[model samples]
Target: MSHTSTAQKKLLSRVRRIKGQASALETSLEGEPKCISVLQQIAAIKGAVNGLMREVLEDHLRAHLGAPDISQTQRDEEIENVILILKSYLK
Candidate 1:
């Protein structure tokens, strides 16, 4: 099974919540809510996305680099690849 399979329910719940947050933001815009309230919703969405990303990254690290069956050289290569991916992603 894929790494995400283990967390599928939780991830889906998070996504649903993010969607709700987006919907609320849209409704707030229609209702002319305070600027701070809108900003807070935006920040909440950002935090949700970041939390999902962090969970996936941690799962990848544990599945690949932390596997007991993986050789040292393979682990080192995986680490480099992960670092490159992170660098590109961050940019």
Candidate 2:
């Protein structure tokens, strides 16, 4: 999609950072890192992934379901359905 094309650089950056975090986590496992330190790295990775998800989701909403030409009622329903899917996905 055009929106994704526009966001390609930003999305790839986030993915690269997430990959670095995963590498750090693996390195930590190979050493004697404290449990809390390892957990913190894991948490950071999770947060980064969630941030990426949020950005992609927002772009999808804006470019597709939130298009200005759609009827209001249909747009509202589509948005609600997207929200429902997101909620389930996060659980």
Candidate 3:
């Protein structure tokens, strides 16, 4: 099985925290629902997830695009992938 590295492990921990925040939002949904508080928590979770995505993207770029010439084809591919991710999820 593939294993996560140290940086990935840290990112997973942060994502788990976000999952807890999302669970809290769901539980709150069943209650009278503190609207503003629940919304704030949701926003926080979204931001955390975004940060995790950014970290993964940066790691991919570093691992795949390393070279004296950052203008290489591999670097271009990395940038294109990042753009695709942003377009698909961040928008």
TM-scores of the candidates are 0.76, 0.80, 0.77
Stretches of candidate 3 off by over 4 Å are 1-4, 68-71
- Between the candidate structures 2 and 3, which one is better when assessed by TM-score? 2
Local accuracy of candidate 2 as per-residue lDDT tens digits, 17-43: 999999999999999999999999999
Per-residue accuracy of model 1 over 14-43 as CA lDDT, tens digit each: 889989999999999999799999999999
Which digits, one per residue and each the tens of the lDDT, describe model 3 over residues 3-84? 2375767977988898899888888888887789888988998889888887777776666665566667768887787789
TM-score of 1: 0.76
| Candidate 1 off by > 4 Å | 71-77, 88-91
Whose TM-score is higher: candidate 1's or candidate 2's? 2
True-structure lDDT of candidate 1 = 0.89
Which stretches in model 2 have alpha-carbon errors above 4 Å? 70-88
Cα RMSD for candidates in order: 2.2, 2.2, 3.2
